[model samples]
Target chain A: MEPGSEREVLTLALGIAIAVVSVVKRHVFRGLPRARRLGIAGASMLVAWTATVLEHLVFFEVLDTVEHLAYFGAALALTSWIVSVPRGFAEPRGPG
Target chain B: MNEALQIAASLVLLVGLVLTPRARTLSVPARVAVAVLFGALFVQQVLDVLERHRVAWADPVGDAIAGAVPFLWGGLLLLMVDRFHTRRLSAQRAQTDSLIDELPAAVAVLDAGARVVRTSAGWRQLFPSAPLDVPLSESVGPLPEALAAALRRTLADELRGAGDAERVPGEDRWWSWVVSSWQDADASGAIVMIQDVTSRVHRETDRESTQRLAIVGELAAGVAHDMNNLLTVLQLHVESMRRRSGSANEASLRSMEEAVQLASEMTHGVLRLAKPGEDEGRAQVALASLVGDTVRLVRSTLLRKYELVLTSTGRPATLDGSATRLQQMLLNLIVNARDAMPEGGRIDVSVVATEDEAQIRVSDRGPGIAPELLPRIFTPFFTTKGAAGTGLGLSVVRGVAEEHGGRIEVSSEPGEGTTFTITLPVGSHARVPQRRAS
Candidate 1:
């Protein structure tokens, strides 16, 4: 495998693993409104990684453009989610 | 346009990472993970921008940074989720502990190892010497042995019900407790709930004593009534003998009549005790004259070991009450004062009349009541004088005062003398003459 292909394949595997773990522990995201936005960011990153891996095989200009767009989407989602997160979201809440 | 959008997204992400309030509470590792995630994403975006502009060196660097984005993002996601879960659980535990601590009843939670894990405010009060994280048996103060045993039984799943009232070994306090075993998926323990029942126990005992006293009073009243009738006949015979006899026999006959009169008065006193609230013979009685008369009567009956002084404010302190009952109430107080000063101390009896009320104060220079015993002084069957006292004198005084729409108050210092003040409402009729005590 080419050096570029190797990096793409490794990135693809890691992205898939993250997506799988998230699916398996889906309950952790339940009731967390911020987690939905986080899930969007993670999914977009996975899409970008998939596009990168596919570009190594098919070598299309559109695939490369798609990869950049997906990366931009992931970054935008993550930034938006962080900005919108309420103050003390990380702070422990008192029991009712 | 895509390049500009990518750069703007990267810059905003970096700014959000810096400005977000969520970043403030992030743990060290979580903060580092987030920073690294943003760094990798920024590098990927920059390298992509450079590569799009046909910089040959940017290809390799862009590929390397791009491959790390997913890995860094994934790591950050997992770290934050785990931290949130842990913090939520900890907060929930803290809330539960706070709720338990504020519970009104004394409660304690013990682990399976019999170590006390948590306690309520009431529990802390009840066992101030008992500290947390210690076994029950190793508590500092005299831990009620029964409570410890109950906890053990609960933990063993042998006893899950309430225990009887157990007296604290050295203390007068009583505690009733309930112990139950509690188990969840992660842990098993016993929840012990204790209630202070000392007051309730005292109330129960007092009720029983009052009931017994009522029965005894009824029996005594019946016997006294019969004896009173016999004494009335004996008095008639003594009077007849006195009228028919000469001066030689008059002294002995007069003594017999006086003995009969004394016996009759004793029976009437007993009858009054049995029916204290009877309004049958109530009349407007002059208190000053009554106090003087009672004082003289007491002076004549007892040995003049202690000086009995009587003073009356020259105002008419009259009451529309049974004169016999009023005299009885005054006599009980004076006699109690006399008994208190067994070693012969001065007894002062004073009658003072205000516009609305009349006060009869009997003070004795006796060893005053202990501060602890002062509250229960007028409680029936409660006494400092053990065998020699029936414990009914002060109670009768209070009863009579209350029955006549009055109140009795007492003040004492341990070393100083004690004073009993009975205040009665001044009756509407004040025409009675005030008599001075000799």
Candidate 2:
């Protein structure tokens, strides 16, 4: 097989394997926040896609690195907010 | 197309969620089915990855196969669930059957079809000839006709909507029945449970009659007391008249005097039944002293040839009861023991004390109480001695014991003889003075 087709096949194979694993681990991974998980998976996918595009395309811009970093920073802030938020914020029991 | 498949798959999952077994309220079978379904779905996804080439995340056919595994798992899960539940049900049913069999009261169950489902040994013994239930109307013939009719109507009402009913079919027997509905896989039926309450009812009736008789006895004693005083006055006047009237006949005077004696004895019997000095409160009594006094009082009369043995250990057993009452109780017990050994046997009267209570035992070597008569010995006016025995001796003994917050018990075998045991509580010596005041 040509290298291009071989790469396509390999990526597809990897995606299917990950999908199976994701389904099986869904019950175990239930403890994590859904939005945070989605954000992480999305960020990883974008990073891998960007690196692949960059290897072929030599275009560069000063704003690109800043934008990427900003996006990652925003993601980290959102995750911290979710994790630190107390569940139900129960009233402390004591004398009135 | 892929988005469309994703939407369909999402809908399928939504449907499954709508039907998911609720954790708090789901049955064992439903819970197992849910778990199996979720597991099977995960397995199907693994299979799809192993078989397929590049596939979109939302390919309906691929995801459909994965989703359908849950339904398939439901079928397999239910079979195993059935086996588990069946074993559990069988165990519960076995426990219920054994409990019914071992019940002391007669119990019977009839199905909605009016067939006898089961009957306890007690039930069989109660009505051996009860025809296999064609219906309640046909089977229970020994029951009073009016009672049977009332019972049938009550049962019909219960069958219409679950309820309970009770009836007294005869003077000696009581019956209660309840109806309830039961559902199985393909059939629904009603259960009828019948229980006999004869012994309990009889006990309650006897207690009521005894109370009524006690009231009557008190009234009779009151009337007899007044008459005795008047008769004594009449006899005194009559004797004075006989001496003052020098010409009065001797035979008439003798007859009148004999009549007066008979009336006096009758009046004494009434006074005894009334328990003349019972109004006096309980006093602390020494067990050894009481026994000695009782033996001495009865030593004057020797109606029986029996050897009397009176013995006690000096345990200082004291009771909170009137001395006269206690003496009377002991006298009655001694007389009973003496009478039992008419031909010539031994009588042992002993006082024993333990940590919590004190006991006085009067045992006789006479023909022991018949097994059937032992239970009824304390009933007022129940006597084996026809006219010779008033049957009030043991009953009065029990009454005295109870008035003192004590109890009397009798144990016997046919050939061995009988033991009458009286148990009284042991109070501290300090309370003796206070008890005397009360």
Question: Candidate 1 vs. truth: CA RMSD?
Answer: 5.6
Q: Supply DockQ values for each candidate.
A: 0.53, 0.02
Off by over 4 Å in 2: A1-96, B1-193, B230-290, B296-307, B312-321, B335-345, B352-359, B366-395, B402-415, B423-438
Q: Which is the leading candidate under TM-score?
A: 1
Could you list the iRMS of every candidate?
2.6, 18.1
Q: Candidate 1, residues B360-386: lDDT per residue as tens digits?
A: 999999989888888888888777787
DockQ of 2: 0.02
* lDDT comparing candidate 1 with the true structure: 0.79
Off by over 4 Å in 1: A31-33, A88-96, B1-22, B51-60, B97-145, B148-199, B232-253, B275-289, B299-307, B311-321, B339-344, B352-358, B370-392, B402-407, B424-438
Error of 2 at A11 (Å): 56
TM-score of each prediction: 0.78, 0.39
Estimate, for each residue in B184-301, the C-alpha lDDT of model 2 and write its tens digit. Answer: 6654444545566655665775677567768978898998899899889979977987898765676787778868976875676577667645254557787778887778657656
Docking quality of model 2: it rates as: incorrect
Q: What TM-score does model 1 achieve against the real structure?
A: 0.78
True contacts kept of each: 0.51, 0.00
